[model samples]
Target: MQQRFETIEQYLEWMGNNNFTNMTWDIEATGLLDETSIDYTASPYKIKPSYKHHCIVVEEHGGNILAFYDGPTYVFDGREYTERLPKASSMLHTEEVVTLKDYTPVEYIHLPLKEFKNYVLKRKIKRVVAHNMINFDLMSMKLVEDMDFTIGVEHRDGGLTTWSADTWMGKQVVFDDTLVISKTCNPDLFGGHSLDKLSRRAGGDTKIDFRKHLAPDVRFLDFAADMLYYCIYDVKANTAVWHWLQDHEDYQLSDRDNYIKNWLSPIQLEKKVAEIITYQEHRGFVLNVDLCEKAVKDLDAKMEERRARVEPVLPPRPATKKFMADYTPPKRQFKQNGEITSYLQKFIERIGAQLKEGDDRTMIFEGKEYKLPLPADVPLKTEMPAKIGDTTHIKQWLMGEFGWIPSEWKETDLTVDQKKIKLPMENIVAKIDRWLDVTYSTAYKEERLDGFGDYMKITPRSTRAYVRQRLIDRASKGSCKVLTNPSFTKGQEKEMCPDLERIAEQFPFAKDVIEYLTFKHRRSAILGGGMDWDEMEDGEEPEKGYLASIRQDGRIPTPADTCGAATSRMKHRKVANVPRITSLYGAELRELFGVGDGFFQIGYDFDSLEARKESAYCDQYDPTKEYCKSLMMEKPFDVHTMMAKRISEIIGRQFNRSPAKNVKYGLTK
Candidate 1:
């Protein structure tokens, strides 16, 4: 390893004063593979981390070699033994607390890890620092301090959570230096925000990549020095970044009260506000379970009525069971394959479209007066599961059978008996030979069979990736033009399919489906919170994902990710189950989080938050700024109606407001 860190004596001599605990630390430890795990080779997450016999390297500002570990001793196999960790005369270090028989003992003096707890208490170490201290290191060190010691995580910040434990040290703050780096700089410099990467930024290295050093055959003590060195090297790197933030940016690592008002810069002030917002979000909003349940149930009932209304316009599900039993998939066609040919071909032929030269793959299907190409988009997928009325099956059947062009429809989650289901992507698994990667795919099946199950299942495609949009575009070929195809992005709010919306303009059935889908999506939101954790009947497991994410105080915490290392754009994290309460569509859903008995909730929304932000940047917040004139408040002129009026002039037909609205938004299509 590279010797990039200052020696123990050299660092202590130069230790400087800083508020919020100048004590930065890091640890390296051995973890036990769970007994249930079939003999190692498991994923890193599966390893049951005990952090046994570890290296906990601490660096404090007002340093005196910890002021406690000087007389520290080690306990092995229940009896006490003196530590023999190889370090400078001033530092007491030991990587393992194993018996003499287990470890290779050398003639050296070290301290017992048992002294760690006492050291913290004696020195009154209220706050400590480490990169990713919340998840791994803090828990491990606490165990060594006292095997049964517990640490409470104050807030879970994805991997960047902050933890605290009320020790004799008076509730020490295990500060994550990673968070400091994230808020202070642009992440392009060091993208992952990992300790190793951060060390590199400080003209240093992580002395040892502990992950690579711990070979299965190697004993824990085999690389003790390397682990200790790594921790020491990292603490210096961690402290260096903290010191830099203090000196250069004039930022405080401590709480809000300690921050100097005069020292705050615009960005720093924003970060300070972000910190408070993060804390507020951590506190979470109150949830009225009864109110939410009633509203969600109302949405479901409304959807059910709409489903009943949509049913009359829909065709019967294709008899996939009969097709599965009687018909065989096509023999892999020359240079291609059509496994679904026979079943869907019947519909194409029924439309009076003759096959082109006995080729089922290429034939124009006539719709009213227009003719469209057969298989206009995408090559044949190797396999289509022979399931009747599967989402893909129903959608394809609708487009093919009716010669219908879709418009303005949003993709709604399909459930089998009210639960989302996924089938194994069996064909891909069969082509394992073509895929060079075997680590996540075809690893020894019997050895890690359970892990393999995870790979076999396909993540069901959202409608944006589904085939219906292409069909909609192809069908719009004769006289009609496709508005846009459906699309889905993770953070964006717009979900309407313009193609579906435009198609629905002429087709009554399409409009019904669009409305049905909108309500269906709202209804689906309730399923994730079908049950609450508070209602668990004694020892009963309330089916996975069914339980509500409510807190003891009946609140649903939507943890905010205020400032990322790469971007300062704030977002509510882990909100997969929580619908966007701030949205106009979710107005009713938003009210479920009541103002409680005493307070009145005065709610308001920005006219165009992003647009206004940009306008602010250029000092053009004028309402007359043409781009800001339409759709977004400031008189509420409809961009959609204007587009529809222009479209009507071109097409020579009266256009309605509903489909036009979808066309203007759902721009993703």
Candidate 2:
């Protein structure tokens, strides 16, 4: 402790002398990490540079600590750090520290990174430990230091909400995050993976509510000491927690020393996995920005053109969206005008007049055959998508399919096409035999979909049962599809959503909507731009595809979560595959990356997560895990709070608070 580390060499030498095998580490940073970004080069660019890692503090078992900072060094004694400290969230621990009304400065030695290359090249730092190694710390090391790692499971020990594992193995390192382990491990034993929580639980100097004094563009020199203080304390806090975990021998993945010893191979694989994820997310893919922007514009225009034509004669429909203010965590039930049951019933019957019941046919999922009812021949004026798993297929086939083409199929151009090779009928009776052994199936809309429910796996003959159920759902509700199984944020969470695909089977509008959603997907994903509630509130036209997610360093961060524990199917996952969030995107919404720093902010109403989980769809969801419990027993708003929280953050609105005028006003816009 008496010897100081002004350079990485001195620290490494000191660590070697003490025979320290691993180092517990931490860091502090500033800026919009991901999702949102700042462009300093714009015309009249008044934006300040933010979004960067500040320091890396490493602590060895011998109580020796070293810190690396690219910022200026500061000299000082003890000064006031402030009395009115920001209230600590459950995740942060600051209740034990005393402060003054202002920030007190302290002297700190800066360790130059000059020797970092040698440290890594020579593998001098044989092992590294830190909280959130996968998400932040390790990721930072890879990006800034070019240090590669063999990523492992987010170390989770079933106890100490913060102790990832109730017992931290002395030889192991804490890298990944609490998030992955919480859901992947036994949910009951999982506490939480938070620095402060762990520090407090570990009975040590906890994490500082650094944000209390944190300000825009002033974190560097102005609050250098404090920022550095926070950095060092995190390392200490993490160290204490690690020791505490080490002291307690709780459950272990094996009989060996620790998780690392038992599964060293798997543990090492984690860093490599993290590396690949970082590559796609931080370094990111070179987007065809121009091509993407054009897709968004052209598709959006086409959707509008189609909607305009269908609006006039379309049957009176139920008001869409069961709840309102989709961007706010708290929800308000939307006023749904009564459904025109009579009119809908009559029209649907009118079209069904020509369709008779056909023989039952068989289809397979995972080699299991299901004999379903097939509708008899129904005249098709034009070929389009189909609506499956519905009681009104025959009618929807005619009306919902051609409702846009003729506006009113019965009154206007109901005239049949003369393309029947054999029969002298008018239009080709699209042998509404979607359930029968009909050859005209849109099930193969995809070439080979392995994730989720083997999309289009039934046959080259029938409509998808699950996708149809979701579309029929979209007709009454909005975009919410259904929860695939579980595996959302918390272990209990799950949602299902697929914008437009199989529905292109029976619905003509599906074509336009599908194309539109695809472009919108690319705009948000590849172009690094998406419209949120605030932009809509400002009446600012939605992002026509801006380079918003791109950072000053020029990369889009699209972090991926590893979900091998929940579903061995996806070794690399992004966003934890939350149905509330993932379901609404295109299945191809993979690998849209630009790296900076950001994480999915989780928010949810625990009461009725079950109900909402059954209301979404994920392309990568496992259908075998689907659960449907009392769907009737659910709140209109509880299911979508997580989704609402994400939109709130993206739009720069604090909608997660008790209630918000930001959300209320945006609803109108």
Question: Using lDDT as the measure, which candidate wins?
Answer: 1
Using alpha carbons, what is the TM-score of model 2?
0.42
Give the Å error, residue 592, model 1.
1.7
Give candidate 2's whole-model lDDT: 0.40
Q: How far is candidate 1 from the true structure (C-alpha RMSD, Å)?
A: 17.1
Query: Which portions of model 2 miss their true places by more than 4 Å?
Result: 1-16, 29-54, 67-126, 134-192, 197-205, 213-223, 244-250, 253-262, 314-547, 550-557, 564-669
Q: Where does the lowest 10-residue lDDT sum fall in candidate 1?
A: 414-423
Q: Which candidate tops TM-score? A: 1
lDDT of 2 by residue, 1-669 (tens): 123456556655654753435667766655333433334335322323434556667676555556666644544345544422232211244342334335444334456645544544433343466766666655455444555554433444575222232112222333534333322332222223466756776687677775454344333322245566777777777777666555544535334557645444454454456446655565443333455455557646754674554443334322224211121111211124633234333433443322123521332323444232212222211222322211123223333453322111010111112110122122212221221222123221321111113332333233555444433333233221121111101111211112223333544444433233334444443343343211121113343233554445444444565433322223332222222435334333432322224744235557544344543433135454322222223332332344345567876753332223234333422
For residue 199, give model 1's deviation from the true position in Å. 4.7
Span of ten consecutive residues with least summed lDDT in model 2: 406-415
Model 1 / residue 201 / CA error / Å: 6.4
TM-score of each: 0.45, 0.42
- Candidate 1 lands at a TM-score of 0.45
